[model samples]
Target: MASFHLEEDEIEKGEETMGSEPEVDEDPSSSSATWGPPHQHGRRRVNNYSGGAVGLNINEAPHVNKDSTPFCVFMLYFARIIRLLVEETNRYYHQYLDELQDGPSPRPDMTDSEMFLFLGIIIQMGHDIRDRLKDYWSTAEQFAMPFYSNTMKRDRFLHILRFLHFADNNTETDRNADSYDRLWKIQTIFNTLNDAYEKYYNPSKHLAIDEIIVKFKGRVVFRQYIPKKHKRFGIKIFKICDATGYTYDMKVYLGKDRTRADQDVTATHATVRGLCRCIEGVGHKLYMDYFFSSPDLFEELMTKDITCCGTVRPNRKGLPDDFRRRQFRLKKGDIRVRVRWNFTALVWKDKRDVYILTNMHCPPAEGSFCDEHGNAIKPAIVADYNKHMGYVNKADRMANSYSISRRTWKWTNKLFFHFLDMTILNSFILLSSCDAKLSHREFHLALVRNMLEHAARGPPRPQRSRGRPPAVSSAISRLEEASRHHWPTSSTSRLRCRVLFV
Candidate 1:
């Protein structure tokens, strides 16, 4: 794709055109009707559907229970996914034992049913594994009764945790090096979940792409430290999410650029492009941050019928020189536009200099808003970018609120918990989309309860604490005698008195 710098004449024409249009107050609900700039005389036509096309049609969309009970929802939407995890886990467990040269031990191997129970307990534990396991084994109370399983002891559960593998060991070495190099142990499971994510639901037209940090402060080659993120050190994942925080696609960022062959393009552009490959030619509008925005990227996405709007860094290449130099000189609410054949860049003065680049929206014919001081106006593209770029942040906040993941030395294990968190988040999104009124906490609690009830026999009765039962008969006799003796004397004295002994 070719990129061009905006000339003086084009800038003048854009300003004159913007100034001549009549200003009309717009309602928030009608924002989608004028999402992008109006079609210009010589620009290529872009699709601006009010509600973007669905990824899957109604007939092809995954069926979710509209009126099922909570338990039924668990069975239909969640049980099978957990079952798959249990099966894969058990297979890997036995394979590890068989490979041991010391031969089979006296302990029996874990069954699929037992693995299911183990996972259910872990989900409800939400604490350090060792501490939680000790409590489950030692506590003698009604609250802990449901999690106790007679078939699986603490040692056995620990064994499963230590050797919990998602993919076959033999085939791990032979796996594709490009995508599965560092994360080979869990790559198969990751791919499986990714497939399910895309197949189950189609997101709306407006999508946001952003990076999420999975907390992992371990000795790993690919660990990242993003100072601005809440978790400063962890694995970074690039995600494409819809307006409702549904993750449509994701790509884990491994250390260096092993997958991409092009060296000239920055990794940010490559990550955005790769995550967007699925929605290409679908006329979906993408909103992003400064890290992933560039004129070249917008130009390339235009070819794929994808329109992008994002804040551009002033230092980024291809921005007009005058806009960069004179940005500080413009008064608040002052707006300037520079247009090429296919690309448009807007420089608006808000609190500071704000640069936005897009191919979808033209210079707004009339849309503008005043600041708090009524001194400056804001462009329509800036408004739209602010509206749609928050989905990824919302998702991150939701996932982190009730994260079940624990601290671990192994990055893969940390990542496994991250996936579990994502699964719960996705399930909440799915349930809410089906018009269910359950909150995130409610959905999770229901799933945990239903899974335990379905997978295990009713909670084992609490074992009574070992001690002699208290002899209450003697105390009862003494209390009765004392009351009888005091009743007569207290009646005549006009004073009420009673005695009890225990």
Candidate 2:
């Protein structure tokens, strides 16, 4: 684990824009005037990757704490974030009670134990799902779940969820029709969790940055529509996760208004920069897709002592115009390389052209062999990118496996669930990487069990359900509380006093 925020020396250098990086000769591959000593066919053949990859050592180096439990790891991230949840929820719940109720308060104010139990119930829902929540409380043979009923009343669960709030609504200025804050409601929670994510654990050097959809179809100004993705339309979250599926950092896409990168920087590039700020100058290796790969970025990262590799779009700036040559193409297992400064651009031919940019890998040893089906060799950079680029995807898959998320009309609510799921995923990763090797489902079960059981002994049971007449209330309450003699239900067998005076 490491500090969530970067200190003085680790802060990201000035944001890099193509215009600002000192210009070099025409990209080596852009020209054919290569009668040089070391350069090759309109390019150069060289490799200088000194930074060795470092991953978390579950039992030793990286996993500083060898003896860790699932609940302890869970608290590392949830302790602070839950406080925010408790405070705002209570504040908003009270405000809601005062505004909506017709007479005196109908329900007691929300308490900490009640809040935790509420969360435990929500977490339980993901592990065990029913068509309707009420079914968990049903007395019918198939529908009855004593576990759910014993945990909390279904109506009380629904009531707390109905008023669950992360931010106060009583005093709000900016979130309106004109100049609205898209993430105003859940902003505090998002930031608090993001901080915990960063500080909870230091990810391995091979980190990946990618976007995952929250699968929302609700009305929103900044909703994304990625046709290729399964959940193609929803809020997009750009996160950097390690090989273990630990989401180290994340930033929600808030459309144009929240775009705060350099003027010339593309939104995608800016996102990568923001997510990478924590690991800057740490000699980490970043793996990303074509959406974020570019020569300028590779070089910029190199300057910070970090190295990276990823697939790149041929049309990206700083690439040779004919980087993806049409007239001349290499056969299967053959590749062409171009070097500019410390960054290398490679094009390998398989079923189709694969363009890759990197400063972390050398070119593949040249050879002609069988097709991909035959498991022919590929450029080292290509293989490395393919291997390490799935960290974020892995994180997404695990989060969705036993998700606490639910369909909601409000984008904030949907995002809140996404955060909840990610937090649990991170905690699972943190614990599993150390001592607990529990499955994603099992970890959640244990987490929910501990959280509920810890706070499960709720306030003492009530003696009366409703008030009696004003004059007789006190006397009737005292008489009802008198337990010297018991009123028993009729039964076939009568109990004999077993206690003996000693």
Candidate 3:
């Protein structure tokens, strides 16, 4: 259909000549038009369309809902997706026995489970449930209801506690230690969510791997230097996002150091290794910045059949002059590469020339691949340019304007700090996948602030000291008594009998 509308110039400029004279080549019985333009060089022919419905469409054009309203299609579609996520999460929680060890008979009201559901729903809806709850319950009198009665919403607080890994046994009132498990859990949840989103994505050959810095608080133990809160930090994430930012696969990494600042070679390598593991066996070309320039890592990845594409760092070590030249000159296992180039230079490597190295062998000429040393070039080719995709650092002229102190973050609750960043990223990915109209970076910037604002809407209720433990019900007492004197009966049956006897 497209070709019929716009053929190549070869077809458009063909040299089909016209005769010098006009003559009727039809029988007298044939219908014909005797029309001619004045002073034409030669006779021309025009075919008249005799098919039906040549002038058909009249009303449908303007009537088709071109209304300037936000389409509810995305809202409905995203709602359905979120609903599925909630149901699946609920099933997973029960299936894995997240509450199994908490007690023998599960509480009719599962506080932890409710919190999980609440958080899941919040994330899925692209809003913070806590903030929404607070907005809905603004007064002390309004909190008298059973759901809102708890001074701190202990269950909800517990959920956040688990999410942040805040331990209950810290000696100092000032001690605010966040747990490792909470951070890991958030990663796990998003990974699972990404997998689920992938099953519905169209299979394209290209995948993009890039990094985006989300502002963070606290000194990351792994990071060498602390970056300003809004300053760039490497967030090594591998995603299979379409041109419109619909992500098929999303893998987020915190970088070599929490700060992802420079001077951490080992951390960078580890980040590459983790990102590479996600890319392995996906049968797509992956892109990276010069920071990913490492020959050993590339070769290791190539051995596993994953091709890489990115600018290679110049100098500092062993790279052959030409990849093609080296292909024949060097042995299979002897190859090693190390990147050493100033990124600020027009061409960072080999006397101010951009360098690219790929197991792909061929890449777009505009993005020619070279070895550490100036080498023979090959035309770049990927199975599909769309599938082997990427977007590098945003042009500096248009970066975000807001700034926050990088140092002040260290004193905050670490898990919430991390959660806040992850939540922004997760929301961006969610909005991108659901709304086919936005780009990855566009979605990241557009909705992230709103999501963070929602997160920062603050508490729905006043903070309080830890409260008294709930009284043990008669059923629990009977269960405890049964534990002391177990009969030759099921624990449930023994407890029931003890309750009646008591």
Query: Which candidate leads in TM-score?
Result: 2
Full ranking by TM-score: 2, 1, 3
Residue range with the least summed lDDT across 10 consecutive positions in model 1? 13-22
Instruction: Name the better of 1 and 2 by lDDT.
Output: 2
Point out the higher-scoring one by TM-score: 1 or 3. Answer: 1
Alpha-carbon runs more than 4 Å astray in model 3 = 1-203, 223-270, 316-318, 321-351, 361-502
Q: Give per-model TM-scores.
A: 0.72, 0.77, 0.39
Candidate 1: residue 476 lDDT (0-100): 54
After TM-score superposition, the amount by which residue 90's alpha carbon in candidate 2 deviates from its true location, in angstroms, is 2.7
- Residue 324 displacement (Å), model 3: 16
Q: TM-score for candidate 2, please give it.
A: 0.77
Candidate 3: Cα lDDT at 387: 34
lDDT of each: 0.64, 0.68, 0.36
Which lDDT tens digits does candidate 1 get at residues 1-502? 1111221111221100000111234331242322223343143454754433443323434455545444554343344555555666667766765565443342444455565566666666653244455666765663355345553577767776776666666765644556658777778667777776776666888889877778888998889776655577889888999987877788887777666788778888888888887788767788877777877787678667688888776667666666556644666566666655545677776656677877667665433446465755546676677778888878877877777776678787788887777777776776676778898877776767666566566434234255433346644565577786653444534543333321
Clashes of 2: 0
Model 2: runs farther than 4 Å from truth?
1-68, 101-105, 175-180, 258-261, 324-327, 365-376, 457-502
CA lDDT, candidate 1, residue 399 = 77
Model 1 RMSD to the real structure? 18.9
